[model samples]
Target: MIWIFIFFMNIGIDIRTLMDARYSGVSLYTLELVQALCRYGSKNNYRLFCNAFRSRDGRPPRFDYPNVSVTDTKYPNKLLNYGYFKIGKRPKLDRLLKTDVFFMPHINFVAFSRGARYVVTVHDLSFLRYPYFFTLRQNLWHRALNVKKLLQHAAAVIAVSEHTKRDVIELCRIPEKKVHVIYSGINERYHPLSAESSEARRVRSAYALPERFMLYLGNIEPRKNIESIIEAYSLYRKKNPQSDVKLVIAGSSAWKHGVVHAVARASGFFADIHFLDYVAEADKTALYSLAELFVFPSFYEGFGFPPLEAAACGTPVITSNVAALPEIAGGFALLIDPHNVAGLSEAINEVLNDKNLQQNMRERGLNHEQKFSWEKCAREVVKVFENLNSIY
Candidate 1:
């Protein structure tokens, strides 16, 4: 008789992305995925690692679990990045974590040894696809990272969507067999709130949101197609002068946002457009639940969170048909061309006025939201790690 031993691996997790104070899509994925992993992969030892020269808190986040530990250093990021680029593979990150395998929720400046086994998550190749959409500094940052060379050495590449996986296989020339499509999940905290609920009423009062308003929440940047949304909303307002629908824009500002501000000022309906800047986490679901509609018209995305998130809150969504939007939101929300201002304006008018459509979308969205969760994402991620573990 043969006796087989079940192997449990020491998995190193890169928490460098979570060190930033800003709450971005990458940070959300990194933090949530790791939290879920700790819950589900109880047998596997996890080492959360980071490198920061200077931080306001001057400490890496520690987990309260026997299976998890934090191994970090106070080193200048710039110097370490340059050293990784110049020194070939002298400084391996896996050695520092001392794990059987390492996983990066998102790619950044990194170095590895000749035999280092690591899996990397690639969010999108928008920088490569739409280079002109980014600023010079952003482009330079992508170039310096040498994404192509890094992916070539990675043990596996996890894409947030099938659309991104194809981009990796074709653009980076990586084998299709090596790339995995693993989506980021909508938080369970995002759920439908009663309109009469105290929390909902508080969010409305805090934001000064009128009862009838549509929402466009995301980074204020060129790639997000905010210009066209403003133009469409302006035209819509011109058409429906008697309507009381306001547009609430909330999110952090990215690069070249002056153009968006200029367009908003010139729209002649600037007073009706409210920019809430950063929103508090507690108020997010309430705001979504209170909104008449949610609009996300980005030109491209590896995977979108807001559309599904809005749906989870029982709000209707109108998003673009291009890129992963169709794949992600086509079944639940109305799809519009990101560039067609007239069409978009019409879409907004149709959705705002059509209660039956809203009801249909709301039901579909709630059902769709159940398809993704942090537990599901983490389970899939651990399976990938186990495959690598079996080799060692």
Candidate 2:
């Protein structure tokens, strides 16, 4: 009877990331995973752990299912992190709740889990790879955590892309077999839209967007290579002086965003560039659909989601060939060297001018987007959990 109870134990999830009102890459991943797990893995019990004090809305994370429960604490994040990392003290998660396995959607974990096994999801190793791009505090936070030790101790590690898995193996020297490559899924609402659609027109009017514009969506961060995009856009305009196409950059500014704005302001065609900061989620698909072409020349990504989302909306993409971009967008979107301003500018011009190529890419992108779904991602993740159960 005791063995049977142990075999069918509850799973605890660290959902502290979801406490934020605005969803970043990791927050979206956590939200989608939790929703999918509740929908598909209803047979198993889940306990969602969150720091209620950190929640943007000051409300506990919501899970509407009989098999799921929420556990909230008012503990501050800074103190908790200090105790976990600096003091080497682990939280008594198993004592507070009878969970057999605890899964952290991100690298930040409660130092100890008593008897519960741990699984962590590593989105990217950007901080280690591009140290100069991150802020001093960001670098210090990662350094304090000792990510290599965390990866080594985890029972299983989930990598969002094959590129990230390889990086983990090479950089952290973690065993290859312990890391699982699970692709993130696009939301169902991101399907292709017609320019004449009501929602599309409404979004255009609301944002005052130009009719024919190239789009770049994501945070204005150093790693995003927004400065390169600005320069490339300037070059594109210079090469086609007669063209009336605009460049639309969406998303809030982050670390060192002044560089991007400075480049754009210095351009001869500064008026042709538009900045719509932090677009709402409901407007994203329509924004993608209305674009003449989507461009993402990022320096690095664990898995590039914006390009994938744009592709799902039937927009032709021109993305970087480096990192996971090629693996994710190859054969569907035009790939270019992110560091080469001339090459990126040329690719953008070529895609925008070629009607036949655009049609072909649209078809291929829609087909490729079909390969990723949250339900499928959830099923694969549950399999990992079940596999861990067999071992324990």
Candidate 3:
């Protein structure tokens, strides 16, 4: 008698982002997705591939689960990144773990075996859209990746938002059917907090936070439209001199951050504007909850996680109408043109003056936030994998 054994499909993930200590939008997405998959995906085997040398602590994130396993190598990121793009040589990921399907959590993909199918997540085409905002090296690296070719070859493409999906279709000319829109979610730690809450008071004292302040929390970069935000804040202060509310800009400096600083320093209310460099993750929820208003007038975003996080905390938001921001925070936020400093300033003034509007926005924002969750996103992603696995 002959007997055959059936095995679960092995799903290999590129978890380089998770290995890095700093958590950006992409890193956060990777962390949340992995946790969600571990929680709900018991039927499949997950092999998390990491470059331990690239990590600050030189260790991969630990996941104590039966179905998940961590695989690490001492190879540095620069060597692998160059080898893949420059020499067209990729690491033999499939042979290492017998991977059936390799999932890249971000656009960066390392070479794998031909036997294994692959999927990649495109967070945004910011480099393509705002070329001037990036450095020469950054632009060259993005161009070298040949995103068009990557999208064409992948078995499936995961877009973090419908706006990003449309960009994939239009910019890369990829088939609409091949691209999937999976909205990212805010962490459960983000929630509405009472003004008198002990946690809020602690965070406030720790950060030297003002009683009433407008918050802008994210990387201080050129594409974030911080220059416009500063200009608008100046106009707001000029228009409403009696308004004692401060503007608190939190987050680490990125490319062209000096321009933002210069603009802020030139503002008439420079003393009222605070630049808190890189707030800890533990303090983010309190920062959002305590803010009178959260302003995110970004020129473009793949999914706009900050606005969603702010809404989840029941903070009224004012985001730009362009890109995914409109879809993510339309009804909940006062959408305005990012380039229009006067218009943005007027909106800020109006929101500050109207308590009823603020209350309505808070309620609407919290309700809007209910539509997104990491578990729901993970299920949808796993379904895509199952469908592709069955077909290919």
For each candidate, what TM-score against the reference? Answer: 0.95, 0.95, 0.95
Model 2's lDDT to the true fold?
A: 0.87
Q: Candidate 1, after superposition: displacement of residue 166 in Å?
A: 0.5
Please give, for residues 280-370, the per-residue lDDT of candidate 1 as tens digits: 6678999999899999999999899889889999999999998888888888999999989899999999999889998999999999888
Q: What lDDT, from 0 to 1, does candidate 1 have?
A: 0.87
Measured on C-alpha atoms, candidate 3 has an lDDT of 0.88
lDDT of 2 by residue, 1-392 (tens): 35544345588898888777677889888988999989998878999887756455644457789889988777867777767767777467765667777888998856555445888899999888888989999999888778999888888999998999999998899999999999988899998889899999999999999979999999999989988888988888889888889999999899988888888899877899999988888899999999989999999999988999999999999999999989888858899999999999998889878999999999999999988899998889888999998887
The digit string of per-residue lDDT tens for model 3 on 259-342 reads 888998888778998999888778888999999999999999988999989998999999999999898889699999998999
List where candidate 3 sits over 4 angstroms from the true fold.
1-7, 54-59, 85-89
Q: How close is candidate 1 to the true structure, as a TM-score?
A: 0.95
Q: What clash pairs does model 3 have?
A: none
lDDT of model 2 at position 360 = 94
RMSD of 1: 2.0
Clashing pairs in 1: none
